[model samples]
Target: MANMNTLAPHVSGSTFGQVIIDTIADLRDRRAQRAVYRRVYNELSAMGPRELADIGISRNNIAEIAKQSAYGL
Candidate 1:
């Protein structure tokens, strides 16, 4: 006779719990990064051509710079 516990696949309680924790952490991190990106983009966009040039950033590259600042990529 097969034991019921042996017949069923084993599922670990800790693994499941860890997965939930990791997911929540990942979501929180993304949200924070998004906030950083938005702030950088908005601040850069508000500057005029001369101001941007003084800082060595071009208006056309504002979005890319914000992305790099927030995501490091």
Candidate 2:
């Protein structure tokens, strides 16, 4: 049989355990970004037309603004 160590390498270098941890961390970051985007959109949507105008945002611009806010220009 081939050498077991050469076949598997070190557990720390490339293993299912590290992959799972990285996947979970990535998922959590995505979830947090989505939550922030939702909160900002809701807050802006709650504003009346007049209130929004005071800040230079009109109803027509809400969608664009939300998109930019979520992911930059």
Task: Estimate the TM-score of every prediction.
Answer: 0.78, 0.69
Off by over 4 Å in 2: 1-13
Q: How close is candidate 1 to the true structure, as a TM-score?
A: 0.78
On TM-score, the candidate that comes out on top is 1
How far residue 34's Cα lies from its native spot in candidate 1, in Å, is 0.5
C-alpha-based local distance difference test score of model 2: 0.77
What are the lDDT scores of the predictions, listed in order? 0.87, 0.77
lDDT of 2 by residue, 8-65 (tens): 3444577767777877897898787777778778899999988998999888877777
Backbone clashes in each candidate structure, one number apiece? Answer: 0, 0
Residue pairs in candidate 2 whose N, alpha carbon or C atoms collide under 3 angstroms: none
Off by over 4 Å in 1: 1-14
What lDDT would candidate 1 get against the real structure? 0.87
Model 1, C-alpha of 62: deviation from truth (Å): 0.3
